[model samples]
Target: MLMVMDEPKPNHWVFFSVAQNSPDFTLTIVFFILPHSEVKMGLKQTIKSLDAFPRAEEHLLQKTQTGALVSVIGLVIMATLFFHELRYYLATYTVHQMSVDLKRGETLPIHINMTFPSLPCDVLSVDAIDMSGKHEVDLDTNIWKLRLNSNGHIIGTEYLSDLVEKEHADHKHDHDKEKDHPHIHGFDQAAEALVKKVKQAIAEGEGCRVYGVLDVQRVAGNFHISVHGLNIFVAQLIFDGSKHVNVSHMIHDLSFGPKYPGIHNPLDGTVRILHDTSGTFKYYIKIVPTEYRYISKDVLPTNQFSVTEYFSPMTNSERAWPAVYFLYDLSPITVTIKEERRSFLHFITRLCAVLGGTFAVTGMLDRWMFRFLEALTKPKRRKETECGSLSGDGCCFGGN
Candidate 1:
């Protein structure tokens, strides 16, 4: 359905159209009190009525329909949830393709020296604020995330879009994990929500921090994270070298690597950061860090340190959830960077398991409900009543 309202002074007309089976499929009324611009509340409502949030719902969802309408709404909801998962899954696919380099069984040990271009890597003083997080894991390994790369710095104009994309006003990172390993078999839609929460955490700077050489360096910002279904902030610090800070310790000790072989072939991907005068740097995001050592031809060691080691994608995860907060294993502590590809792949496999399982479970539920709806369309057979002859003695005896 579409509506057009004309306002002569502005020489403009408002156009509003509602989808056939959407919740906001009927006439909508809105009120606005704006003194500055000519764009009134009516115009705002019209625009909002047209912009369906897809998987999300408005405060007042259409609820009049009883049978058929409900079915349609359910179907739409299913589609939106699936799409949300697909978008994140695709995003992970892109990240995974750009970072890892190894076959299923290939091995690369740590403790090797490597050399790369001596280009000047840009540096920045970071101030990380964890909107949500939990330190339920072991004290030593509390902030571990399961990804192929480390927490990276943004460099160059290439990553400006991504940097902007990940930014949000409030970072909420309390993603709950069930006891299910790798992936849960059901609740695919919920999984999508979880992925979103994780992304928000990472983008909003859950654990990102920096410390200058000063007296105040003893304090780390509060990281807001939920623990075992409780909302709380994980306190950490970024200290001067003389005194150790909690967040600084985690950042310095954390390790990242390849989840699989062949994620980036030819050579270990190199991430280059060019800092211009504008206090911003440029980055080619899909490249690996300049830290791996290629001993002879076939053997390689990956334990070396490079600046860009923080932003490679060696595994397939829907978003950067692991990098943001503390991940839970049976034990709940974050693990350090692995020296071999097997360890990395194991972690990546677990992450993919979660993502794929989420998609599959939701898809199945959607299909099942659709099938139920189709069954409802079948015509019901009615039974006919047969009248036997009345009692013989009565006048209504069977006709001869």
Candidate 2:
């Protein structure tokens, strides 16, 4: 050591230290890489095992005729049960819900296609009233009043609104000053024309076919067609000789919206006045809004209503106005029914589950049954062989 020892360079010292610890470095590398290599190998082995088909002994694969028949029957039963489960899964469905509409003043159309056998088209007038004190009387627009004969044959068809419009158009220039004044103008002329038409029809003694659509506010309202004239007060006060009008009706088609299959309207039928007394027939209708959604994504908004009827007969002093009244109220809640089918992916997953589960269960049952049968027969065969050997020994001893 006393001999001159030169100082070591930084790079040389670092290289020498690393070389001295080469064994630790090699161990650390092996520690990290070994586990990763083992994991990769294990993953490959697991995949290989999963991909490989199951293997069985030659004796296990062999089957007797009875076993084969039983296996076939079991498979048939399993298939039936699987299909039943599939059908049940498809049939069991859920409905999606939505919020109800609570807004007011929405209008709904009431379609009427009625035939009056005794009420003349002239005197039969349509009127509607709601809880809000709004009244619509003698509706003519969008209404067709067809005159019928005594035998219920169509005599003439008239659109009341059209006649009024035509008369107004004809006298448009002649009554410019009258049109400016609201006292006696277009509406008065229309009313005069309507009265004339009604008088003509009454003179002919014609039956009525009332068919039209009436748009009413979404509230409790009653619309009635009565024999009492538009000027009811004048008729009662001056013309006290007015006779009682019969109200025998045949409702052809009545609904809230366009006709669809399986839709039922309570009033679409033959309604006759059994008693000869003058009265009012009232239908209290409760309407429920419905939305029908098809699998093809077609959505139809419609309404369903239920009705209870009441008839009020006229008293001796009361005026007789034979009419049919529809009083309707709408519900706040709406029902949305959607049609759907099982998806392809869902069906495939269920099919696989059913097939795999059935096969596994049946296979286990079959194996257990085969083992039990073998165990039961083995003792019996062994006893029979023992008895036969004993008999052979007895014969040998006797011969000796």
Q: At residue 216, what lDDT does model 1 achieve?
A: 11
Off by over 4 Å in 2: 1-99, 135-141, 162-205, 233-243, 259-261, 343-400
Instruction: Assess the local accuracy of residue 182 in candidate 2 as a C-alpha lDDT between 0 and 100.
Output: 39
User: Superposing all C-alpha atoms, what RMSD in Å does each candidate have to the true structure?
Assistant: 32.8, 11.9
Worst 10 residues of 1 by lDDT: 234-243
Shift of residue 2 alpha carbon in model 1, Å: 61
lDDT of each: 0.29, 0.64
Give model 2's TM-score versus the native structure. Answer: 0.52
lDDT for each residue of candidate 2 in 1-400, tens digit (9 for 90 to 100): 1334356433332112222345455421111122455666877999888875778888787686657766787789778977876786576343545558665656777888998876666666666566665434433347789989877799888774432211212211122333465364334565667656655555565688989887776776666676533444323322232335457687887787664445678778856644455666778888878777766678877777788988777555543445687788877878676767778688777777877887787777777878888899999998777767887566534643
List TM-scores for all candidates, in order: 0.16, 0.52
Question: What is candidate 1's lDDT per residue for 285-341, written digit by digit as tens?
Answer: 122332332222233322222232233321222221212222111111212222222
**Candidate No. with top TM-score:** 2
